[model samples]
Target chain A: MPYELYYWDGIQGRGEFVRLALEEAGADYIDVCRGPASEGQGIYAMMAVMKSKSEAHIPLAPPFLKDDDLIISHVANILMYLGPKLDLTPEDQGARHVVHGLQLTITDLVAEVHDTHHPIATSKYYEEQKEEAKARAAEFIDNRMPKFLGYFERVLRQNPKGPAHIFGDRLTYVDLSLFQVFEGLRYAFPRATAHLPTQYPHLAALHDAVAKRPNIARYLQSERRIPFNEDGIFRHYPELDKNAA
Target chain B: MPYELYYWDGIQGRGEFVRLALEEAGADYIDVCRGPASEGQGIYAMMAVMKSKSEAHIPLAPPFLKDDDLIISHVANILMYLGPKLDLTPEDQGARHVVHGLQLTITDLVAEVHDTHHPIATSKYYEEQKEEAKARAAEFIDNRMPKFLGYFERVLRQNPKGPAHIFGDRLTYVDLSLFQVFEGLRYAFPRATAHLPTQYPHLAALHDAVAKRPNIARYLQSERRIPFNEDGIFRHYPELDKNAA
Candidate 1:
């Protein structure tokens, strides 16, 4: 059975989380809206399919996954579906709930990141709100970054299993996502993240461990992975970067 | 088994969605955080029970659910966990995916609502971001509103069950959530929703049908149902309201 992954090729955005899962799982899948199609290829063709409505069920956005019989949307929800399928979620319901609670916290963090730039509006240009972004970025840098990262660091530190994996000892999708958040934060806020890992050794180790995972390492090296850029969610605006002092 | 809900007093905010699900299902529960301390107790005590450490798996935020041995957070994730338990989700994986898809869309909508006033920064006053918010709010009202509500209207139209419910003939968690979004939007963007409801009959019908459901109806009449207020996500600012004229 073939799985079709749909997302805009213009930016990594939210789609990459799902992509990371698929890559790590080594699933048989195609980045439908992405990849080569010669003349009518890449993201354009994928967009055509999404807007076409010929496909059985339409996903609300690109990050949706189409398995043989199921079309799943929502980043965390998609991970929920793929988790048990790929041994990423714990078998027990209680554990899964804890994992989900943590993922939702990550969702909150991601929203904050988006806000650091857009602040008041998603429809306008970031430049239009550049002044607003500066203030929002300051509050985010001062309050939110610490609040969110601190919560995760606490979760890691308080984990019963010696502060290793977020939920279970084995790597879960939540762990992988935390790694992504750290990577994106570092890319976007190197000055901030440099000071961050020191506060949470376990989180840093987990981020490093996930990056070293064989499949992720391969995927990162491969051309399939899209590089982070200004257009993407974690864009680095040197102005938003905190001072090292 | 007792179920406890923790959130601030007054205004449904995010907690309303959870309240709707619990009410619709006629579940045995308590809205502890909002209830009178003499009878229901404050959030601190609610926190005490939640963080008892007997389970040691307490949620990081309010609006979490504690049912017997399981606890969950995130509005949508909580619904996902509760959907099956309350028999609000479909039996098949495909249907469940669709339901989860809608829930996540609601999450996006919620975030957008928060952005309307806090377009520049959530940590600062709306007054500070008023200018940027005016621009963002205009785009949100003009573009995102129609896009989101229109897509949902299409979902209802395409539901294959006479467009009475969001999913099918029966009431699903998503249906209740859709109604909540309608109520929130109406409260937050009264003029905008009014101008647009005629354009999406299916969604309008959904808002009506869910309102009349027995349990939901009772809950609305009860004082337990908080009115929309400035403290919540969907704030009503006259400037942001679309003039019916």
Candidate 2:
């Protein structure tokens, strides 16, 4: 059976990380929430699992995956499970843990990115927290962004296999996730990230390389790739994207 | 050789979650950063691993565990590795994944708690962002706290074994971590959490039970259990603890 991926229909958000891995691997999966309820799919289908009392494993939030009898949640946890199955990770146990660590770090950066737009409360709207967001974004662009990007760049440079991939000689799910992060940041902080090509040469190169992959290129050019919008974790607010002038 | 845990010496922070697991399991481990630099076991020792060129698994931050040749970071990742070795997780693969997912949920809660004091910039001091933090903490107390706590309470209530433990009949590292979360929240927001005992009776009971565990009880009263202070993730600032009243 094809895996059932349950997430919000509109935004890329955290679900995109899981989606990218599936897309790149040419894995057969259904975006459950995107389908109609008449077919036993949609938000209600996803909610049924979330609210299910029969299942011992309960998901705290969405972006959960179901394969036959097994269910998994948390982007990193789900990706870790899929990575090996899809041949997106290394064969060695130690190398697998390193890739998992990188994925967790990406999750950390994503959380910080989400906070830049919603500094005070996730429940509140962006307009309500616009002022605080401006200040938060300033600090993020100045300090946190460089810190995280630089760390990834350092990891790439230090990779024994080469700087082409975040891990060994072959492509891993982490490389794909990094490509998505590069896309989201460039879209969200156009002005703030204008110099990324020069500042993060390895990351820029990896991003360019991932975009050229046959499966990923087809997916990106097709309607499958979601547009970055105000509703997503990485949202563009010109006021919040300003760099020091 | 015993396991080597590298974390910040002064604060419990994220490291405490790992420390609690080790303490509860009665595992032989060294708090690397807590020892003196003369013996190559202070902040420098932790920094050395972070900056080391020889190791393939470079940790992005602290709270990394070194077991023989393997080095694992991220609290949940380390706990997942330690869970089975320490006999804290179920033997079934599916059940183990559920436990790991639950631990990841706790990690999510802890991150939100940290943001209560550092709402804007983590690099900036709490005093510099007092106003923003006050607003953030208000929402956390009113909305996020109850939302997370309620989720865990539901998980407990729905457990097939009973509500006595988070998973099965025997205690797990999750129980120990939850106990720490409870202690930290109580210390951080005394007034805000005064009604927790009544509102979340199961969690309160779990907290009490974990404390009554002989090893854990001794750890709590010992010097190893660092007191919650302004430096830690959960800090008590009266101005940030105001509830609806």
Candidate 3:
């Protein structure tokens, strides 16, 4: 059976992170909610899966991968499972552990980005907390962005093999994630992102390299890859962008 | 060789989250930051290990666990490692996924609690962010606490066997974490927490059950379990607490 990815129908929120990895790996998978043939998912469907009494044994949340018997949830956890199968992680345990550490760091950065908009409540609208978002965004652009990006760039520049990949010479899921993060920050904060591009040349190169990969390139151009929108995690909130130092 | 848990010596913050599970399992481990002379630990030694670059790998922050060759960082990841060792997870893969999902949810809640005080910037002092923290804390107390707590309560209530554990009748690391969340919230938001004494009674009972486990009781009484203080994640800033819920 093909991998089953359950997530919100419209947005490329957390689920897209998992989707990108699967798509890049050329893995046979189904986007459950989007196709006409497949059943659409809403919050209630998600709740029913969680709350409904079933021997089905529900995974934590959407974006869980059911390949054969393994049910992996937690965006990072799913990636951890796929990393080896798809050859997205380094073969060495130490390198793999470091890559995992970096993935968890990305998880932190994503959470921070999500919090900038949903500072008050996850269910509440971004408009409801615009002022808080403004305050939070100021910190995000000036402080958090550089801190996370700086760390990633540092990992790239300091890579003993070369500055080409995050872990070592070869591409890993983190390289893909870094591409997403760079794409996301650039989309979400163009003004700040533009000036800071040259500072992390290695990271910029990795982002470009990942984008240029044949499978990922095709996925990006295909209708399957959702466009970045306000509904997604990487939204172009002009107010959040600021001039970089 | 014993497992070395490298973390802050002062408070039962994130590290304690890992400690509770390890304790509850009665697993043979040493708190590398704080332990008796026979047990082997000291503050200076822990900090040195955290900051030392001589090692092949270094965590960006503490709460990193070392089991033989495995040096796992991140609270959830460490618990993921311990969950299996301690039999704190289900035998089935699907069940393990649900437990991991619940674990990640706890991770989200912990982040929210941290944001209640550091809504501005992690680098800034609580005093510096006091004004913003107050506004953020209000939203958290009024909205987030209920939403997260309600979700966990639902997970418990939805369990087929009973509402006792996160996954099923058998105890998991998530149950140990639920205990910590309750303790933290009760300390940080005593007024608000009291209002829900019986709301999540099963979760409450689970918390009690985990705490009373002989190993956890020994750890608590053995001067290893640090008291909640201002330095930890769940700090009680009187101005931020709910005077009356």
Candidate 4:
């Protein structure tokens, strides 16, 4: 049976990290929520799984993978489970832990990115929290972004197997997720990340390398790749895209 | 050699989650940063590991576990790594993933709790973001808290084995983390959580059960359990603790 992946129908959000991994590995999987409701595979279908009291392991939110019997939740958790199966992780156990840590760091960064726009409340509209968003975005551009990205850059630099990828010499799920982060940041804060290549050369190169991968290259150009918009986590608002000091 | 856990010395912060598991299992581990500086263990010692260029697996922040040569970061990741060793997880692989997912959900709630006090920026003081914090906290109390706590309550209610524990018939690290979350929420928002026992009886019962565990009871009264303060994630700011509507 094809692996079933459930997330929000629109926008990449956290699901894209998992999608990218699947796409890169050419894994057979169904984007369940994106399918038509007529076939019983849409948002309602996804909700059925979450709302099922009979299900022993119902996930709180989406981007969960259903492989036969097991239902894995959380983006990082799903990726960690899929990594070994997809061969996107190293064979060594210790190295796999480090890679998992990197994915969790990405998870932290992604949450921060979501907060940049919705600083006050997820229920409130962006216009309602525009002033607070501006402040949060400025701080994100100046402090949080650099700290997270720089840490990744340092990791890439310090990799004993060379700085080609985030870990070891080949592509891991961390590299794919970092590629999504780089893309999201650039799309969200064009002016702030205008000098990304100059400032964080290692991350920029890693992004470039992932973008050029045969499968990832095709995935990016396909209709499956959703465009960044105000509805998504990394929404671009010109007012919130101030250049970093 | 004993397991070495590295985190900031004063406040429990994220490290307390790991500390709870260690204490409950009666596992021999060193709270490295909490030790006296003369003993080659303190904040400086923690920083040395984070700042070490020679170490390939440097964690971005603390509350990391150094089990011999392996360094595992992030609260959920650390607990997931230690859960099996401490026998805090179920023997079934699928149940283990479910428990890890629950822990990751706790990780999300904890991050949201931190954001209540620091809506604008972590670098900025609470005074600087009091207004935003109030707005955020109100939402957290009204929306986020109920949603998260409600989900966990349902999980317990829906447990097949029993609602005595989160998974199977045993107490996993998730229960311990949830216990910490319950304590933190009560400490941070006493007025807001005044009806916690009435509203989330399952969780309340679980909390009471975990607290009564011999090792845990002793650990809570011991000096090792740091008192909640303004320095930690769940800060008690009266201005941000408006009662739920």
Which candidate ranks first by DockQ, i.e. highest? Answer: 4
lDDT of candidate 2 over A1-245, digit per residue (tens): 99889999888999999989999999999999988899999999999999987676588898888988878989998888898889999998767777888899999999999999999998899999999999999999999999999889998998878899998899999999999999999999999999999999999999999999999999888776788888998999999997733
**Candidate 3 displacement at residue B18 in angstroms:** 1.2
TM-scores of all candidate predictions against the true structure: 0.94, 0.97, 0.90, 0.99
Off by more than 4 A, model 2: none
- Write candidate 2's Cα lDDT for B1-245 as tens digits: 89999988889999999999999889999999988889888988888889987666588888899998888989999988888889998888777777888899999999999999999999998899999999999999999999889888888888889999999888888888899899999999999998888988899999999999898889989999888889988999998886534
Model 4 segments more than 4 A misplaced: none
| CA lDDT of each prediction against the hidden true structure | 0.80, 0.90, 0.79, 0.92
Per-residue alpha-carbon lDDT of candidate 1 for residues B1-245, written as tens digits (9 for 90 to 100): 76777776776888888889989999988777766677847777677754554344456667787676566777888888888888898888778877888888888888888888877666778898787778778878888878888778777766666578777678889889999888888889887777666888888888888899899999999887888888898899989887532
Model 3 misplacement above 4 A: A37-47, A50-61, A66-71, A90-97, B35-57, B243-245
Instruction: Decide which is better by lDDT, 3 or 4.
Output: 4
Report the number of the highest-TM-score candidate. Answer: 4
Full ranking by DockQ: 4, 2, 1, 3
lDDT (Cα, tens digit) per residue for candidate 1, span A1-245: 76777777867788888888888989888887677777445777666755754343455666777776567777888888888888888998778867977887887888789878877567778898787788777778777888778777777776677577888578889988988899898898887678777877888989999999999999999988898888888989988888533
| Residue A43, model 1: Cα distance from true site in angstroms | 2.4
Candidate 1's C-alpha runs over 4 A off are A38-41, A53-57, B36-40, B47-57
- DockQ score of each predicted structure, in the order shown: 0.54, 0.67, 0.40, 0.82
